[model samples]
Target: MTARIDLTLDCANASLLAAFWKTALGYADEPPPPPFATREEWLASFGPPEDGSEDDGAWLCDPDGAGPRLSVLRVPEPKTAKNRLHIDIRVPGHGTPAERWHRIRAEAERLVVAGGTVLAESDGHHIVMADPEDNEFRIAANPAA
Candidate 1:
């Protein structure tokens, strides 16, 4: 038997991280559970915290329903260490080394615009990047893909 899986991210702001991920991955925000007409209706049952942040948790899904579900969980503490596990964004590029680097850099730039920062890069290989919450991930070239 096989088990299904979802990606979970612990961060300070679930909503903000979810938004950034959705834009970066071309995902869509998950709707409220069944019987709730809207997200607001679901939230009203418990009410927002004193700070007035509406989101306590958030979920993002691939628009085509092909990728794993992303669950953003809000936590009080900030990320103090590098991620033990990180995501690698692969961009298909079957060309020269320069072309591959270009593709990777382009993707990294797009992610930067979506709240990610370029940390470092390996020539003709991968670009290490960090999300808004400083979660480390990589953008790499998949030439054989």
Candidate 2:
């Protein structure tokens, strides 16, 4: 018998990190649809409101569409230093290095707008980015320099 496995990340903003990874790795955001409290006055079947005090707002997804799902846990403390485990993304290059850079650049721009920092990357390699909580990751298609 084989055992299944999954990955989980404790992050500052689960939703934000999910979105960033969704784009960076082509993963679908499978966030559980919002659940609201079903008021007696209303005839809707809403479950309940999320516990504001718990670490419940987490993000999850299956990036490769083959591997087990990964989750990001929302927390109060900001991320410090580098992650013990990190994800490296690779996309099939269609044309020039400049073209690839452009695609990566666009992603960097969006991530930056969403509170990510562009650290650094080698030419034709990839760019280093940190999430809102400063969790660093590399986005690149090249496997070697």
Candidate 3:
């Protein structure tokens, strides 16, 4: 059997990032593990942190169960450099180059309204964008037709 993987993102505000990602990726808030009706209840089992800080994090899962789970955790330090790895949101469609680019730009605009900032564009290829926390990601037009 193949192993499943989950992606974790460190941020200053987990809830805010989670909300943006949920909109970007069409993911839903992950349900608490079995035997716990609510996330608060499950977290309570772990007790408070050693430093007495609140456990600030959010978990998200693809509604279709096809994508890796995402975990956004709150951290003390701010992001100072570019991310070596980033997510690519693909816009796949069967159309001419112009049509494909339109689709890509449309998605990028939607993301902009969802708290993303467009950094660069490659015309008919892809667009680089940054999330609310400045994590870089891409919106690409799929070459497959």
Q: Which candidate is the best by TM-score?
A: 3
lDDT of each: 0.85, 0.65, 0.91
Q: Write the per-residue lDDT of candidate 2 for residues 21-115, one digit (tens) a residue.
A: 66655667554544633222121344435444233444456656675676767766766667987766555557777888887777777768767
Local distance difference test, candidate 2:
0.65
User: How big is the positional error of residue 90 in model 2, measured in Å on the Cα after superposition?
Assistant: 1.8
Please report how far candidate 3 places residue 123 from its true position, in Å.
Answer: 1.3
Question: TM-score of predicted model 2?
Answer: 0.63
lDDT of 3 by residue, 1-145 (tens): 9999999999998878999999999999999999999988888889967663334899999999999999998988999999999999988888888998999999999999999999999988899999999999999876664
Q: Which lDDT value does model 3 have at 119?
A: 99
Candidate 3 residues lying further than 4 Å off, grouped into runs, are 50-55, 143-145
Kindly indicate the candidate among 1 and 3 with the higher lDDT: 3
Write the candidate numbers in order of decreasing lDDT: 3, 1, 2
Q: What TM-score does each of the candidates earn?
A: 0.84, 0.63, 0.92
Model 1 TM-score is: 0.84
Per-residue alpha-carbon lDDT of candidate 1 for residues 1-145, written as tens digits (9 for 90 to 100): 9777899999988878988898778889877878998877787778667765557678788888788888888888878888999988889858888888899999998998889999998977999999899999998987567
Report the alpha-carbon TM-score of model 3 versus the true structure: 0.92
Q: After superposition, how far is residue 137 of candidate 1 from its true place, in Å?
A: 0.5
